[model samples]
Target: MSYLEFLGQYGDRILSGTLVTVLLTVLSSVLAIAIALVTGLMRLSPNAVLRGIATVYIEIFRGTSLLVQLYWIFYVLPLFGVTLEKFTAGFVAVGMNLGAYGAELVRGAILSVPRGQWEAALALNMTPARRMIRVILPQAVLIMLPGWGNLLIELLKGTALVALIAVADLMFQVKQINGTTFLSAETFGTALIIYYVIARFMITPFMRWLERAMQRKLGRA
Candidate 1:
């Protein structure tokens, strides 16, 4: 069959797969952002205990392979009587893994903020939480925007791994189509184009808009 005909036949399946991929990406990205912010702040906590906990989490997730983490969470966890649905396991694994990396980005960005900002907040009698929220994080977020954008793109590509957990993401659907039709070139090529389109047209644009918005908020635009 021609490419158009093939697409016509399987378009619904492709759409379903695309929707699943988008869902996984959005959910995982949200989780990763939250974890990064919390763990990154913990890394800078005055309490040694908090810093130690963050360090251990970062090391464990960053040092290990994500595939192993996925297997452990999805397959091996049942041994300990903890079971997560495939989609849950997939996003959790991906989010935690990426969050470890993003935490470092957050830490670095926060550190990059001028020391004067912290002192100025202190002079104003701002509490630690208030200082960070009002004075520090606003500046740090601009520094971290590019890094976060890159991480988000990586997260998008990484969604392919979810297919291994039977989450029915784009890659899973493409693989299934290829297996049945043996149309490696068409199936895989379509998937490649779709991913590129999503990244280029969706993620990239959103990131750019976010950067612009932040810049305007900070009066840099």
Candidate 2:
């Protein structure tokens, strides 16, 4: 059968899976950003207790594999009477695992701010919250934007793993099509192209825009 015919035949099923992938990416990314912001700031905190907690959380999540975490959440949790839906387990694991990695980016971005800025904020009697929210945070955003973009792209690709957990993501649909038609190359190739379009056309340009906006805000544009 022609590739076009194959595509037309199973397009709906594939589109459904793509929708799931898109939803997972959006949900996990927002959560990851929040987690990155908190843990990132906590990592730079002066309080040893807070820093230690943030450090431990990052280490635990980053050190472990995402697939293992997903399995633990979906399968093992049930052993303890804490069953979760497959989609929930998938997003939670992806968000948490990526959040740990993102926290490091946040830490580096914050620290990249010039020391003079922090000192000036202090001299001006700016509260700690004010310093971060008003001063350091803006500057840090320029640095963070690139790293955040990279993480978001990773999240987009990472959605493929959700299929393994029965979340019906793009990869799951591709596999289903392949099974029914025995056309592995066509199904997987189409999915790969779709992912590339999302990452290259959508995600990359958005990140560039964000970076430019942050730089303009800093008067560095």
Q: What is the TM-score of each candidate against the true structure?
A: 0.98, 0.96
Off by over 4 Å in 1: none
Output the lDDT of residue 107, model 1: 99
Question: What's each prediction's clash count?
Answer: 0, 0
List per-prediction Cα lDDT, in the order shown: 0.94, 0.90
Q: What global local distance difference test value does model 1 have?
A: 0.94
lDDT of 2 by residue, 1-221 (tens): 99888878998888888889889999999888899999999999999999999999999998888888888888999999988899988998899889999999999999999999999999999999998999998888787888888899998887788899878999999998888888999999999998988899988999998888878877898
Clashing residue pairs in candidate 1 (N, C-alpha, C atoms within 3 angstroms):
none
Name the best candidate (by TM-score). 1
Local accuracy of candidate 1 as per-residue lDDT tens digits, 102-157: 99999999999999999999999999999999989999999999898889989998
Model 2: how far is 13 from its true place, Å? Answer: 1.4
